[model samples]
Target: MTEDFQEIVETFEFLDDWEDRYRHVIDMGKTMPPLDETLRVPATKVDGCASQVWIVPHIEGNGPEAVFTFQGESDAMIVRGLIAILSALFNNVTVQQVVDTDAAAAFAQLGLDQHLSAQRSNGLRAMIVRIQSLAQNKLASDS
Candidate 1:
């Protein structure tokens, strides 16, 4: 796991209850800067989510070795927090690392895997897919 995400895990361990964890997640979202409105176009928009969602990829250097990150947003506060969590999981990693990470297992460590509603879970999976697809595309292009 990325150090950023490990911090979240450690925080979750400190929190006493699910409510507190949820609050922490929401708080994380609250701090995320809103994505620029102009970038919320169709191309960046993620489908299959019940709430509106967008992720704009930011890559540094070039090719498969590039460091990958993104700025993301969602209409729902909880979803936005989820995006922040994903950022912790993915940000600053190589495009190859982003593609290789087991996001499901990482989220499982947070205990969100069991707590999220089916719809939210689906939405999360959709977001992961979008992220992985972007990394895969980058890798392919570089090759």
Candidate 2:
């Protein structure tokens, strides 16, 4: 949801420093519901991440209006926060919306790109690509 991203931006704007923001992000990760153990398979695992990450996707509805929802986990706390942020930003939205959404822009708005290491940033991009791939696959199936 765009509003959700906006809210996140506004919330982070109030924090005084990057350290505070990082803590807020880790707290956000804590709020995410734990991923089920069954979904933590190799196929669901996101490669290119320095940390172990697994993502599970479910598509709801049909045709252009289908919504792509995701659940994910990571072995690292920071990566878990990244996964939580991605899930919140992309989940329960239309397939076209998911494809069109600019996650980089949101990450930029949050100043995440500046704060992250190169490897972590690459992992984040990998996660976004995975989400987009899921949406594209659903669109093809609906067609």
Candidate 3:
């Protein structure tokens, strides 16, 4: 649903080495504006991650047609970069589209699933689940 996500895929394709891709992910995270400390509440806190992570959803408009966007942060640099990647994955899309997206496939395309630690992969799945849950909730309210 976002061109930025496609751009990420293309960028990943351009980077041949894992180390360069890793740095690129970290650099992507560095570019993200920090999430507000006050917003890092228990409600936003993501479990199942070794690193502390928070995601706050911001939905605009009503129902399935609503836009889905979120602000996320993580204590770990790599996790923060993953959050940036997720932002590119889900931001500014319709709630319905968010619910329908194949996030695992997208990440697999980026070859992230093969490279990430098991814990990090689980954490990434957790983040995607959280985002999808938010979108589902939006759709439910619309119905």
Candidate 4:
């Protein structure tokens, strides 16, 4: 999964400009499998996003080896793209791995902060926090 993430980052690096990168991000969002509408309820909606966003987390097993799965959606294309990147990065990772992952670093690696609007960046941080909170809850439950 890390290798896959690295590949995505490298791919993003190949794009020439922010406009092209935004298009690539939108394309990534388009590739995401349709998320279940029922999962898009208020409880799942991530707060502070500039657009509507939903996140559903599923944890399997216990400890460092526990698998964490996430399904998410966002109304805005760029926001959806951010979710797609997060889904690719965190999905199927262990609970510990999810908790340990530095989402801000990942965004920095992708040059997100430099290119995105402040509102979009805030939304991105909200998304990361929501996912990390889910992982933390799973860890707490396991203990």
Clashing pairs in 2: none
lDDT of 3 by residue, 1-143 (tens): 48999999999999999999999999999999999999999999998899999999999999888999999999999999999999999999999999999999999989999999999999999999999999999889788
Report RMSD (Å) for each prediction in the order shown.
0.7, 1.1, 0.7, 1.1
Tell me the lDDT of model 4 at 42. 93
When 1 and 4 are scored with lDDT, the better candidate is: 1
Among all windows of ten consecutive residues in candidate 3, which has the lowest summed lDDT?
134-143
Model 3 lDDT on a 0 to 1 scale: 0.95
TM-scores, all candidates, are: 0.98, 0.95, 0.98, 0.95
Where model 2 places Cα greater than 4 Å from the true spot, the runs are none
Model 2 poorest 10 in a row by lDDT: 1-10
The CA lDDT of each predicted structure is 0.95, 0.88, 0.95, 0.88
Number of residue pairs clashing in candidate 2, backbone atoms closer than 3 angstroms, sequence gap of 3 or more or interchain = 0
TM-score of model 1 (CA atoms): 0.98
| lDDT by residue for model 2 (76-101), tens | 88889888889778988898899988
Tens-place lDDT digits, model 4, residues 15-120? 8788888898899999988788878899999999979999989888987789998888988888888888998889988999999999888878888879888999
Q: Which prediction has more favorable lDDT, 1 or 2?
A: 1
Cα lDDT tens digits, model 1, 32-140, are 9999999999999999999999999998877878999999999999999999999999999999999999999999989999989999999999999999999999999
Off by over 4 Å in 3: none
